[model samples]
Target: MVLTVSDLAVARGGAPVLEGLSFSVAPGEALVLRGPNGIGKTTLLRTLAGLQPPIAGTVNFPEDTGAYASHADGIKAQLTVTENLAFWADVHGADLVDSVFEAFDLVDLRDRFAGTLSAGQKRRLGLARLGVIGRDVLFLDEPTVSLDGFSVKMFASWLRDTHLALGGIAVIATHIDLGLDAPELDLTPFKAAPDARGGSDEAFL
Candidate 1:
């Protein structure tokens, strides 16, 4: 499947931040989003993931093919690592895939309560949710925050050797390079004018 964004415009706090942006991601491909902080990488990802409506243009992709992973860990602290993953898998109408534990290095902590895991572990669990669900397109923002160098490499390896290798598509907004050999889309030129399209309170963050 292909993911396409056409002349898209997105706003933060009712004021536009990005506009007239167009791009596409083919199967087995990933697009790295690059720009200074607050440059609307998150906004654009949200728009593409259908989390919010774009100010203009369109996002076209196959149905039920996208998953968005942001800073939010979405971990149920009360539950164990396995249970947390199981919950999300079920919610996405997918089986609790055992491979997720291996992918994110959660095997040793499977029985540990999510609330008790270290910050990096929690981050791993959150990211692992992406694998648990059977989606092919990923929209991720700062997926490596709190992760150590080794964990980051593990995540990168999973993306390159597993996800992309299996025909998955990803659009990630992260400063660190995952070495996926993917093309980059810098949002610098797509920055909107200071007086773009609104003066309301729906800021992009």
Candidate 2:
């Protein structure tokens, strides 16, 4: 299913940050969110992902076709690399594939405990979870955080060659270059009015 947003207005700290935003991401496509820091990229992504109510606008997409990945790894410290993927896969009724391990360069560490991994390694393991689930739409914020230059390329390659190739749609907010071929949506002009602050849930329409 295609993901579409129209005249979207989003808030941060109960104050509107971005508004009058419109965009669509078709299956097999990706869109990169680019703007200065505090330009509300995260807020926009959260709004699109339905994590929080938007001040106003419409977000259209099939229910349960999306997944959000924030900066946090969200991994279990006690589980091994393989075990971690197994857990998420089971939750989604999917299977752990070799590509997921190879994509994140976690093959050598398959038996390693997540708690003992370094920061970057842990980050890779966390991102590897995306491959475990079969979700078609990805809302990612700073997905490459803590990853080294090489690991970032691994992620970029996987995202392009595997994820997008298989008809997944991604809306990502990142400062670094993951080498994605997606269009960039700059949110600078969409900044909300200074007076666009708190309002009732009815305003979310």
Candidate 3:
């Protein structure tokens, strides 16, 4: 799968956040977004994932081939870990629930209620859904949040084994370095200037 973004512009609260950005990701490739907070990395990911419309430019990718994982995790609190994975597996017609559990070291927590899990555990469960869905293009936002060092390494290994190995494309927005040598886009150059409500923005001036 290939994802092509041409001169993309993204906004927040009716104000542009990122502008004149463009890139492409081929199958088996990963593109990392790097910048400080509030630089629109989240917005750019959301726009590419089709969760929000871009202010300008084009994002071209096959329909239904993309999956997005935000920082929120989006787990059903009352559901068991396996139950959550099952729901998505059913939805996406993917039958890798057990494998995903093993991938994230959740085999022991299969029957545990998501509500009872700690923050890092829930984050793992949230990310595990991506594996179950089996989408070709993944848009991830701060995917390493609340994870310990080992878990982070495990997550990176999974990305290497499953997604990239299968010729999938990934666009990740994160501050932590997962040690992947993927090409990076620093969003500071693309940040939108503050409007008249703020003082003259030297970056744009």
Candidate 4:
């Protein structure tokens, strides 16, 4: 499995949020996390990305898994769009190429300074980082939060197309549904643990 979760559980403020949750994903697939607010969707994604350790359980990745999480400020504010991408490319040890610019639709903005770009533009640039790297699995949390409808559609389309083109695994946690082309694992219940206590409050504590 490109990604695997076994008996995962998490707690915040001394209360368990997710328990006994397990799932797996392979290449050329996209998994979506759907849930109400404050239900641990982001927490699960963070755990899967290895940004947070689960209270109990295990997450396994392939030996060469390349991963990126949201809110990392992938772009260098002091640099132009191309410059920022080049920096990431260098970090990932990837060959800088025009395809990364074409993948994220940033060709026109390549010469523009990253700091002056809008939030949606910056997010798109961040997504473009994947194209520059050779990661087998990709993780994105709320990737479309600041995007307008047009940009959102563009990104969804791009994501679907890229999965097909590269045969990679993409896991995204977003409230706005992308209608992805791959199987989606809705994580709401796993996050909330609706059946965790079996309707009894006595065991919750």
Candidate 5:
């Protein structure tokens, strides 16, 4: 499947952040979003994930083929790791719980409550949702936030093997290196220039 974004403009709090951005991700390709903070990286991901409205342009991808994983680990504190993954797998119509658990190295913690896991463990559990969802395109926002060095490497390897290897697409917004040689979209040039309204003749008079 292909994910396409054309002439996209995104705004936050009624103020324009990015404009005229265009890009595409084909099967087995990964696009890494790189830029300093507050540069609309998150907004762009959210927009492409269909979580928010774009100020202009279009994002086209197959329905049910796109999955989004934000920085926050959306896990239920009271649920066990297995239960958590099972819930998402059911929601996404995926039946790969055992594979996902193995992929994230969560098999040992299958019966552990999410609330008892450490930050890194919880992050891993959260990321495991991607496998359970079984979508073709993944939108990851700072996926390595709470992961340890080894966990990061493991997740990166899984991404390369499962997603890219299987002809899936991924768009990741992260400051850390996932060790993948994906093309990058720096938001610096796409940043919207400040409005020029004050320079009008009426203001100068």
Candidate 6:
């Protein structure tokens, strides 16, 4: 599914976080959001995912949408990888087994417990959730954070390949290089004006 934002504004802690920010993601397109820490990168991704309400403007999402992956894995520590994926697939009504597991090289780790996995492993599992759910639009925040160099490269390859094969859009916010052909959108370029309280504000499409 395609996503479009226009004149979008969001406030957190009674302070303007994002304003006048505009960007769009067509099918099979990958858009990266980059900015310094605490610049509302996560907020913008969450807003695009429709998990956060905008104070002004609109967040447009396509009709056939499903699934979300936060910075955290969202998997139960005690559960096995197989169990976690089964639960997600059931919730999202996805049935492709080999494709999802092979994409992230998780086929062998399916029987391993999530708690035993390394930080990079957990991130891979979290990312794999996106494919299993068959979501039309993928919203990822700092997807490569905490990942080892090798794992990060692996994910970059998987993201580019899968995005092309499935014809879906991936919106990622990260400092690390994804090594993909995705376009980058620096949120700082679209700055917000400060309100009367000496706070900043901005929005987008």
* Ten contiguous residues with the weakest lDDT in model 1: 196-205
Could you tell me the lDDT of residue 145 within candidate 6?
74
Q: Estimate the Cα RMSD of every predicted model relative to the unseen true structure.
A: 1.5, 2.6, 4.8, 5.1, 5.8, 3.7
Considering only N, C-alpha and C atoms within 3 Å, which residue pairs clash in candidate 4?
none
Q: Each model's TM-score?
A: 0.95, 0.95, 0.92, 0.85, 0.93, 0.89
* Candidate 2 Cα misplacement greater than 4 A, ranges: 197-205
C-alpha lDDT of residue 196 in model 5: 13
- Model 2 has an lDDT value of 0.90
Candidate 1, residues 140-170, lDDT tens digits: the string is 9989999999999999999988899999999
Summed backbone clashes in each candidate are 4, 0, 0, 0, 0, 14
Better of 2 and 5 by TM-score: 2
Q: Show where candidate 4 strays beyond 4 Å.
A: 13-15, 191-205
Instruction: After superposing candidate 3 on the true structure, give the runs of residues whose Cα lies further than 4 Å from its correct spot.
Output: 194-205
State the local distance difference test value for candidate 6.
Answer: 0.77
- What local distance difference test score does each model get? 0.90, 0.90, 0.86, 0.75, 0.87, 0.77
Q: How do the residues 27-86 of candidate 3 rate in per-residue lDDT, one tens digit apiece?
A: 999999999988888878888998778777899999999988887888999999999999
Score residue 165 of candidate 6 by CA lDDT: 53
Q: Model 1 reaches what TM-score against the true structure?
A: 0.95
